[model samples]
Target: MTRCRLCGSEALESVVDLGATPPCESFLAADQLDLPEPAYPLHLRVCTGCWLAQLPPLITPEETFREYAYFSSYSASWVEHARTFVAEAVRRLDLGATARDAFVVEVASNDGYLLKHVVDRGIRCLGIEPSVNVGAAARDAGVPTLTAFLDPATGAAVRAEHGPADLVVANNVYAHIPDVVGFTRGLRALVADDGWVSVEVQHLLTLMAENQYDTIYHEHFQYYTVGSAIRALASGGLALVDVEPLPTHGGSVRLWARPAEAVGGTADGAPPARTTAGARGRVADMLAREKAAGLQELSGYAEFSARVAKVRRDLLRFLVDAADRGATVVGYGAPGKGSTLLNHCGVRPDLLPYTVDRNPYKHGRFTPGTRIPILPPERIAADRPDYVLVLPWNLRTELLAQLSYVHAWGGRLVFPIPELSIVEVKP
Candidate 1:
């Protein structure tokens, strides 16, 4: 655990620490409230060798994802993102002319949010999900799914049963795995020689730059940069082909890869992504930018911890001031990120009352550590609180649009991270 996760180097430096906290997604029911909950050290480190930021495991994945409350379908914007991604992949990958039934595989495919789009296109798809409850939901929706952790062995079994995939989609899962090497190598086994592998993860540069410490939790084991991604995927015999920055999850990057052997790899080692002239130019530019920003050195992380500490004080001050004025403040979205923000700031129901979420799984449960009640989004209008704190600030546009009725009651929206500010909603 002390060694760097990507390069296995002994040269690792501390980045930021959130102290001991419960797993963000570990919400509790009324009966379970009486029981003790576990907490672990929440720290991040950057490898001096590969420059990848990561959190060493204090808990196992078995304990973290045994039962999951997140359902992607609950977010209308996320579903639309999936739908558009499918349509583009279909056209760009030449799946229609190549074969309308191109084989597609998605790892950590939660509730078939993206795979359902593949199904609608008549493309053959399989989901490798570890969550038992969510996997059942995917199955009921007519998507073939397997309940297993993906490694080289299981990935081989998947390709054997269902023909080799034309495209292997791993959206936002690279950061959740502890074995970065094994999981990326598994992509090679699950795909055909000429197939493509796509992985989307929150960019580490954006995380520290934007003060997105809320995204830090036990469920996410690693943070990625373009530099680290190349090393991690290459270790698994895959080569990065292309990279695109995305707006999802505050800021993210979608990486396209292919088997190393297909891109002129030697027996000794695999080459990096096959950069066409333009691709090579862009990759070099990005690496240069990261290096210029001191991302490759330990000094780069020095300012982050102090910035995060100030954020906690600022948010607490803002909320406490609002409560003193006798203004009611309720929350929107009981997201995992909200758990980190609430628990870190020592917020209870007193500072912020109940929150709301569209996911019915979390309706009756309390957020981990902070025992704030969760209600449906309808309550925001019913209560018509003076202020509605938007917890998932990354989706402010979508949340604001959906809860447009809040403006009717003269309710203003508040954002905590990056900075504490009030957003005026317009009809």
Candidate 2:
């Protein structure tokens, strides 16, 4: 029996099965154009004991992130999101005058998107990034970065060199590690006696309720709920004291944690009885709702898969009909989840023609399995396809706003997940 990666519980029930899919980032090479692609089982399961949602094992970090291609700097929205996070974090930590020279460390810091904001305030910062290409981008952006994965040993080295961090930020990367307990322990070791660690991860409850099963790829080893996160941190000598909901990446939670002794003590060395009751209550309610929805049953996922198949059929029918009418259809946003959706629906070059991505590195490459070429977003304006399919449907509002120019040509936008529909642009 497959056991839960977090709590080692054998009580895992299949939540969704996306069938065989290529690796999310395995963009194809030109020379291997005709080579058949390999697909792995894309399945999600929930641990009954800890309430962690995760995919059945496929790839490891060494295989996935060693020379990663995705860069955070490519997305304007993501850059703005990082800036906002830095501002809020600095204010909450009271680092303006008191800790002017305080050190801030970010684990899995992608392309120095967040660190640039912290360093602009004259705060000393370091970024630990495993991807060489992305780490180089961080350095180019004037952020000091170490190209290595964060672990207990690396944490010790960082402390010996840069001193303990006053604040540590890990965004959207908390679920990427296989040894999650060990990773949290490393964060505990690097944090100052009074320092705080903040991590943002996709919310499991939202993933299930919204039928976001496509996000369950091999790179994400564990999906976290606040209850499971608190337990995991407590095991590593840390405590979660606060939670904030963020709208980025479908739905996510920003968790604030610190060493157990750091709580109930002020920066001025006084005891305070502050509590995070509101955040805790919100999280508890979400967990209860998930349990009531039968998240622990295999039948629940079978129904979900059935719905997904219906979406696939409907999308294919629409695309075939559009093609019959000589309507050109192309895809926007070559996101990881977009890859999952494309593969699950058996989309090929004949259906999508090509796709456009904001990331320059992904441009000029072909998507795996489908072999659909990825071009720059500018190509959308130049080509002016009859219908533009927004694969990352969660970002429909943002994408539609950005691509409003299509309206001038009387073009319509299509959303292919959850359902296939042509949406009218609202003024």
Candidate 3:
């Protein structure tokens, strides 16, 4: 982009350009396969002014989420993670004792994966989601949902109808919006004047450190470090009170914030000073760590492009070597990140042949740009491929256990991010 989206600065610097590719989640159907598909430039730029890493808003959220294919409930571990988060939030916020009086709202709540727990506690809850199909699924699960995107007007309407939320939970969706400031304000509008807002986004520090370039897709218009996150929240009159490093989606940060008014400042106005006692020392410590990692300046990103190139080269080498040896290699998951990795590495059906996923929505479709066929998980054992390329490597631990049965026929698994590695599994 010519100017940084957050600060409107012209001081944008290059981080990495992963070439052009189609929207990662735009899986093709059998009939549409013969038609031409569009691709967009997938370049990530960092703003010196705000230190916010971002991509051009080539695709809108409506194009990606209107009929979304991802369902959070498909992953058993993710479900348990949501359950734990809800239990902890209830105790931490004392919502359980006043369940009848409390209301929880989750932005971008896919299929009520997290809000189901709130419903179980008898606390009023609502999911604000844009995808009609997934929102329908959430309602069928008995979780109240509003099928709409969260903008300032929508947020205000929700507050007017259901009243302000006691807690607003936004997980993994903060980076998905291009209008960072507007979305944050929508968050502020939805939350109570004395309520809390919790956001979980992939931390840029770990993304660069762990070489997680595949996570950069059209859907995620921006990336954030702790310092940048603080600024983003401040733009919406929310004060950062605390933050916790999480192990989800490679690496993430669960930020605990509140209305600036609740944190001893004016709301819906300019951000207040960062010296409030409500601001914990952990926030400062994380900022120090980010600065130590060279995130505040361009020095931290100097070597990221090279590291990303190495990943592309190493993966191609492995796939080529496997093909020459006449070994069968199928893919494990059809995650959006997989599209970036596959397209960036120039992998096609010839190299991967097909992939499998637990989610049935993608069963009869093909991956976005690579056009790799997606099948049911049972296909892995049916064909007994010599090697299975794991796409959602962020879930390394969980997938290892689920695919342990691959050991039956001397099969192995390949993980391609943070360097390529092949491992034998035992059940």
Candidate 4:
């Protein structure tokens, strides 16, 4: 019954019902288990009005983010990705020598993993992170951060204090926001007249095409295709300038936007060719590809619920078979996606005994409802488990390299999503 977050329309269509699952980030400690845990409807809906796919946040940002457990520093690959973005962004926006006093803002900046690189380059940067402990950590690392959630008002306050931002960067943080219009308007508010806002979101087309249902957790309120994203940005006075497809997060798109008012120039009777085409550039092509893949139509989503069920059954069969044979199976990372996948697949501690995380904050905590023990990597080396289940399959390359010790003991790696992929052990 919830209204669509994007178009403010009641004409919403159900995409999939992942059933009720606990808030993905609410990792619990042993003592906390005695208390009742809250779970919410993980139903996803699509807006017929705007064709945007989204989920009702089910919980407030405060409930989901405050005293957060997820940290970006845990992933070496993600950190490298951030570093690369900084380098390319400086070149793209000409932020290096010319835009010296330019203020760069990162929304939901975690542990200053990305901004630290910007600051190291002597560029002025600010991180707007909502999680208090996470913001303090960013500040501790010398990335000036505001301990506040981003909205239109927060955006105004930051602009008044620090002046307009030359470049506003939000990597994978935009999807987590429920009031994305307000968040986008905020980006439009603080961006310099001619400046641009850059965002990275996992493409919805990719999600549907690849059957990545594990990613449909409650923390992420929206998934965007190029067309839907451009429409949302246009609502907030921003226009898409260009887009680049990325390999990160299964498949993601990096969008560049400028003030809507700044799109057209005085050179002709109409706007520039790029601006006239809704500033499509390569973005129009991407949108056409999405349309060709049937993402723009309603029928594209109808089959997903059945697809999710089949994958769940497949994963359950694998885990049950492994357990019956007395083989050990442990998880690599207890991420939000992992929580959804585990709960959706009805995986319990018996099938997958425990999971390991690099973050010390999560080491003592247990996965939401499954109550799988979150342990340190040292435990894996100690136990030499027969099979290691990689929950964060997006970082499999980095994780496989780190967990190579398991292979030494005749162990193998397992991936559940996009079908079961068992990494072959090299002798």
Candidate 5:
């Protein structure tokens, strides 16, 4: 029996199956083309005991993140998000004149997209990044980064060197770890008595209710709910004092946690509320709603898979029809969820042609499994494809606004997931 990673519960149920896929960031090299690509079963299961949603075990961190190709500096929206988060954190923490000299550390700090803002204020910031390539990029950007994973041992080492941190920020990387207990313990060890650890992860309740099974890749080991997160933190001697909901990555939750001994505060002192109720209360309502919507029924997921297949058929027809009419169809945003959608839907270069990304590291590389070449976003403006598929559909509004220039050529934007639709731009 597969035990729960958080609560050691064996009462688990298979929720959704994403089929076999390669690691989203495993871009291929030219010489490695002939080698057989490694694919693993990508399935999600929910622990009935603690209500923690997670994927079945297959790959390890060493196998997944040794030389990670993803860099956070690529996304314009993400950079802005980080900058805003730093401003809020500094204000909420009440760090005034000392803010310039206060210590801030980020776990799984991919390329220091957020930490750079902290350093810009003259604050002493440190980044713990496991991927050597990504860590080196952060160092190049003038952010001090340690090339190692955040574990109990590593956390102790960091505390001995840099002392306790006033702020510990980990964004989007919270759900990618397998050892939930160890990871939380490391957070407890590194944080100061009054310091807070902020974690942002995609909310599980939203993923299931919205049919966002494409986010069930191997790298994301766990999907969190407020209840599950609170329990996990308490078990590791940490307290979750506040939470905030964010619209990024479909739907996500940003949690503010401090040592168990620290006193808690009210919602007014926390980040802006994104839901009608507080984070925990909103999560409870969502969980109850999901159960009422038959989330536990396996047939619900079967129907979801059917909807996905229909999307694939409709999108394929559109792309092929466009190509026959002498129009080029390309894709935008090479995100992890986009990789799952592209590979599972069987989209190849013959159909989608190529994809463009803002990340320079991924510009010359090919996506895993599909092997479709990735180019810089400038290629889209130059090539002027008749249709550009926005893979990260949640950011449709943001992406459309940025790529509005496509309307200059009478080109349209296409969205595949949650149904295939061609957007009409208002002149």
Candidate 6:
């Protein structure tokens, strides 16, 4: 983009160029193998003024989320993670099972993975999701989901119908929207004046530190450090109150915010007593860590491109070596990040052969730009390859256990991000 999406600043600096790739989620059908696939530049730029790293809005959300292929409940760990978050939110917010006024709302609530926990507690909850397929799954599971993107108008209408929500939850979706300010305002519109809004997004600090460049894609329009997040929240009339570091999605931050007036003060009283002691200190500490890591300036990003290059080189080398030795190599998951990693490294079906996933929707499809066939998870056990490349390395622990059966056939699992590492599994 010519100017920053967040601050409209022209002082954008190159962070890393991941070359061009098709929208990561656009899996191809067998009938369309010969059809032309469009690709876009997947370069990342950071605005010096705002320090928000972003990709140009090459593709729209409508193209991706309308009939999304991803289903959140497929991953057992993620489902449990959502369960835990729901319980914690309910307790932390003092939401009562029988309280007639208590209500919760989640934006981009995929497949009711988290809201189902809210449903179990007998607390009234609603999920505002954009994907028709996933939203149908949510409703089937008994979560009240509205299939619509969260803009100011939609949020207001939801508020009008359901009344103001006591708690608004947004997880792993803050970076998905191009209109950051408008989305934040939508959060503001849905929440009660004194209610809370919680957002979870991958932290730019951890992404750079761990070489998680594969997470960068067109759908994720922006990345945030706490410093940049605080500024972005202010743009849509929200105040940052707390921040929590999470281990989900490689690394993430849970941001707790409220209406600007709620944090500052109400008209009739001083600021409502909140968790100022712990939250303010944590926010300060995280910001300090970001600055010390040089993320607030250009120094921290200078070597990122070099580091990303090494990952691609190492992975390609491994695949080539395996092919040369007549050893079969395959892939484990067909996640969006996997598409970025595969396309960036120029890995095609000849090297990868095929990848397997538990999601049936993608079983007969191909990865967006890489065209690697996606098969069912059973394919791995049926034709155990010498090595299996684990593309969704962020779920390392869970996947390790899930694929441990490969050990029966002397198979190995390869992880490509944060550095290349091959592990011998124990069945």
For all predicted structures, in order, the TM-scores are 0.96, 0.92, 0.97, 0.96, 0.89, 0.97
lDDT of each: 0.86, 0.80, 0.93, 0.86, 0.80, 0.91
Whole-structure CA lDDT of model 3: 0.93
Tens digits of per-residue lDDT for model 1, 160-198: 889899999999899999989989889889989988898
Best by lDDT: 3
lDDT of 5 by residue, 1-427 (tens): 3899988999888766678999887888777778999998887777877777888768888887888878888778889999999998888876445524578899999898999998897888899999999899999999999998888898889999999988988888878888888888888888888788899988776776666767778899998876677777776667666667788888888887877766542222222233234654654555465566555444434456566567668877898898899888899988888888888888899988899988787877888999999899999989988889998888877787888989888888998867788985544
Count: clashes, candidate 6: 0
Checking candidate 3 for backbone clashes, the offending pairs are: none
The list of candidate 1 runs beyond 4 A from truth reads 98-101, 265-274
Please identify model 5 stretches exceeding 4 Å from their true place. Answer: 99-101, 263-307, 320-326
Model 6 misplaced regions, further than 4 Å: 97-100, 265-275
Better of 2 and 6 by TM-score: 6
**Which structure is stronger by TM-score: 1 or 4?**
1
lDDT (Cα, tens digit) per residue for candidate 4, span 39-86: 889988899877889988678888888889989988899999999999
Candidate 3 segments whose C-alpha is farther than 4 A from its true place: 265-279
Q: Number of backbone collisions per candidate, in order?
A: 1, 0, 0, 0, 0, 0
Pitting candidate 1 against candidate 5, the one with the higher TM-score is: 1
lDDT of 6 by residue, 1-427 (tens): 8999888999999999998999988999999999999999999999998899998998999988999988999999999999888888878889975645699999999999999998888888999999999999999999999999999999999999999999999999999999998998899999999899999999999999999999999899999998888888878777788889999999999999888887772222122245578787887789889989999899999999999999999999999999999999999999999989999999998999999999999989999988999999999999989999999999999999999999999999999989999999998
Residue 21 displacement in candidate 6 (angstroms) = 0.4
Q: Each candidate's root-mean-square deviation in Å?
A: 1.9, 3.7, 2.2, 2.7, 4.1, 2.6
Better structure of 2 and 6 per lDDT: 6
Q: Give lDDT tens digits, candidate 2, residues 1-427.
A: 3888777999988766788878888888787788887888877777887767777667778777878878887777788889898888878888776626688999999889889998898888999999888899899999999998888888889999999999988898888988887888889878998889999999776776666766777788788776667766765667777777788778888888888776752222111235466755665565566557665444444577667677778888999998899999999988888888788878998989999998888888898777889999999889988899997777766787888988877788998765678976643
